[model samples]
Target: MSTAHAYYPSAPMPITMPQKPGYYPTPAHHGYGRVSVSPPQAESVTTSGGASYEPSATSSSYAGSASEYDSSGTNTGVDLLDYMGDRLHGAFDPVPLDRSLAKQAQTSGELNAKHRELLELQALAQRRLAGARANFADGMRAAKEVQKDLQWTQKRVDALNERAARKYPAEYKSAQNRYPAPVDY
Candidate 1:
């Protein structure tokens, strides 16, 4: 269990008390900052609706398997308080402190491994985001370039059409007769 001094001092400090009239003394040390502790892990048999964290036969009492709890009267799959009370009072064989410490160390190791994996994933996500941003920029540039090219091509085609009308008047007139200009709205 973790312990820390509470806010709102319970007793007045001797150092803070003024020694003489109109003599204000500064505190040698500051107040204790926030002491954040990780929330207690739930002692659930199952983890987030996943596989059971069944203790070994020696580690636990009154159990054939984790699933056997449903059939057993001792454990109704509820009443965490009662379950802990039973363990504390030795209703079932108590787990050794050293063994419990080892279990905790193992759990810490697993958590560290998971943390590393998560960090790697975060790095990968950052890389992907950077790549996506670059690709977007490249695509935008390409689109703008294509639009400019299309405008230039259209201008060139109009110039060619004008030239054709002037140079091949007879042919152009025949073509215009075959395909009349579209009516404006």
Candidate 2:
């Protein structure tokens, strides 16, 4: 007859230690040395003010179940072709009736609007240039008049100096005595 050992659920498992000294000592104790080595009791996590959270039966399977894309997610072949055609035509094909060209044509009537604008700008610039030329000519004339006035004033001063020397011979002689004429002159 075979004998079966009885199992005791309440008893802790036995651990064997090494017999020789210095060969293998006991494992270095953790924070609590030589203390009882039993499995830690399960801790109950609670919220603030000691409120325990108990999940409802329906909550376990409800996450992300209702959120989903529409069933008609696949694109039809015709829709894809139309989308592709639109993109291709927009990239490669020239527009037949451009609004900008139509607007220009309508505004210009017979002459090109851009060309007319250029001509108007050129005429305005020409008018400005002519006015600038007239102003420059007037400035030159004023400068010449000022030069003529300055020459007349200089000639009058020279005449006055000569008359003063002629009228006062004694004073002129005294001035000459003080400052003799240059030898070269």
Candidate 3:
């Protein structure tokens, strides 16, 4: 609400006289200052399409929700009035303030819980990854040991064949003639 004073020494201090709905005083009339326009009355506004609408929602079903919005006379001196100064147009209306706030709080709590759960899952995945890496390293070491054992056995077989060929060339030559290829162990 703008409190720009419209003073006339002959009339009143603020000129509390009601002005027309859309009418505005010139800057010169109000001493070249800003003037606040009055609010529209609690009436239906008509459009060019012959349609009209009320400012606030009003219905027979409003009775059920009215109890939720009505104040318990706890607020003492606050003047709650609409633009047209209608009591029925202002404070009596009920809103879902409390229930909406509670729902919002519940949603916030659920979101926080989900965030915590996601963090825990990520941590567990990291631990599992570390364990898998360690297991893979151990398996590679074991494979290297097995390869070393296989190489040692193949070396011993070749050494034994060389010794036999030198000690008994005639016998080895006859065996080679009989079996041209090396025998499988």
TM-score for each of the candidates: 0.40, 0.32, 0.42
- Predicted candidate 3 versus true structure: per-residue lDDT over 32-138, tens digit per residue: 23222222223333444443333243232223344333333322112222223443435555467777888999999999999999999999999999999999999
What TM-score does candidate 1 get on C-alpha atoms? Answer: 0.40
lDDT of 1 at 141: 100
The candidate scoring highest on TM-score is: 3
- TM-score of predicted model 3? 0.42
Location of the lowest summed lDDT over 10 successive residues in candidate 1: 32-41
lDDT (0 to 1) per candidate: 0.54, 0.51, 0.53
The predicted structure with the larger lDDT, 1 or 3, is 1
Per-residue lDDT of candidate 1, residues 1-185 (tens digit): 22222232222222111123222332223222112122222232333464333333123332333543232232222233333444455564546877899999999999999999999999999999999999999999999999999999989988987999999999999998999877979
Which regions of candidate 3 deviate over 4 angstroms? 1-95, 168-185
Q: Order of candidates by TM-score, top first?
A: 3, 1, 2
Cα distance off (Å), candidate 2, residue 66 = 71
Runs in model 1 lying further than 4 Å from the true structure: 1-97, 166-170, 173-185
